[model samples]
Target: MTPRVAVFLDYQNVHLSARTAFLPSGSSGRHGHVDPMRVARRIVRGRRFDGELATVRVYRGRPSPDHQPVAARASDRQADRWSRDSRVVLVRRQLRYPKAWPAEPAQEKGIDVALAVDLVRLACEGAYDVGVLFSRDTDLVPALETVRDLGCHVEVASWKGTSRLRFPDSQLPWCHYLDADDYAACRDYTDYTAA
Candidate 1:
């Protein structure tokens, strides 16, 4: 039987990483954006086991409307579009704003924990045969380890030239390094910022 693959995406992490790896210097945040379904399909196709894409779980922090109205609207539109796909599940948490407002950036408070929780929980529930995480955030390493311990096959994906989460036990947790061409294929060119 072909393995069922669930893709877990830490949206901000992957977005920033892809921007760093593939976009031109000084490009805006909107430039390197990727369509979640496109990336999930690309990842599934890259696997040697002939996996079927079961779902794409996207974890992201919603922008604060009071602090950044334009960004908040753009984010809402993007979320609506991404979640329209039947296989995509988008989970968004409120972003933490700084006391100084525009002087400092809003941060993602609980996204990693949420993603980690689902990663382990889904593995235990037998939601998919394989879990592919697309984030370079090391905070997720423990969750990946936990899922692997539960007998769920797990893998990590990162843009070329970027770091990926590593397992303590050497040789475990294979990684798929997507290069510029792969990034190009998954790019979402929609300028969400445009009115």
Candidate 2:
């Protein structure tokens, strides 16, 4: 039997990294959203999985209704698109902000904890034979270890040379690197609308 695979995306984590590495040096932060579905399909294809995508879960923060109008639309559109994909599942948390928002605003407070819980819970429940994390955040390491110990094959994907982790060892998941071409192909067609 081919390994049943579940892909979990740390949406903001990956998005920020992609923006830093894939966006042209000075193009502004407008167009770096990668199609999560495309990203998952390409990774699964490369792995030659057991032919099942048990789950494609993306974790992110839903901007509160009062967020800046323009940027929030793009974020909402991206989330909506992902939710509509037959193979993609979205797990979102609320974004928190102080009464007086900072210049950069706030990030999703509980997303990592939610992801970690789900990863371990799903693994224990036998939801998949393989758990592949599309992230570089070391915060996921403990959960990955627990999943591996529970007999799930754990793999992590990141931009080539971007992760400082040395993996496939007893402590970390087996590692794979995503290159520039992958990002170029999966990047969002329209990440922003001109004002």
Candidate 3:
């Protein structure tokens, strides 16, 4: 029997890493501007999972008003296409600021907590045979462990370019980390590029 796989992506981190590590400096497109559906397909194919793909959820936030509208449109289009073709789900959350913030502190909000909560819930509910996480945040170690203990395989997907900053095995020994670069090798950028 084929393994039933569900993929959860941390949109911001993956986007930043791709921009800083993969794309050339001074490029026009935003760093995480990749087609989530394409990435999902690449991952599923790469893993050679046996069962039908149950879900591919890409988590992201709305763009700031300052960003060009075209970018958001492209993202939505890609998401819609994925939803139609492969049951890909797009989760959008707003960025929020904490009260009594320190001066010059980085803003934090969106997906991380949501992803963690969903991962635990899904694992406990036995939603899928395997869970694929496209992020390297150590914050997820607890959730990863919980899922693994529940008899679900948790695989980490991240770019090889940031191998130095990738999650250490000491954090979650049972989980497997997949290099996104290796998966990207099989994709054709032109096919997913928005005209």
Better of 1 and 3 by TM-score: 1
The C-alpha TM-scores of every prediction are 0.96, 0.88, 0.72
Count backbone overlaps in model 3.
3
Off by over 4 Å in 1: none
- Per-residue lDDT tens digits for candidate 3, residues 1-195, read 777788888877777766666667886554335666666666677674455567887777754323435545655555666578556777876444345433433243757888888988988887888888887677876787788778888776766657422234564433333355644553325333366
Evaluate all candidate structures by whole-model CA lDDT and list the values in order.
0.92, 0.78, 0.65
Candidate 2, residues 1-195: lDDT per residue as tens digits? Answer: 877888899988888888777676777666677888888877787774454677798998877767666666767777777778777888887788876786667768899899999999999988888988988777878888788788788888776657633354553556657778988888888654443
Residue by residue across 165-187, what tens digits does model 1's lDDT show? 88975755888889999999999
lDDT of 2: 0.78
Model 3 misses residue 87 by how many Å?
A: 1.6
Off by over 4 Å in 2: 48-51, 164-172, 192-195
| Per-residue lDDT of 155 in model 2 | 83
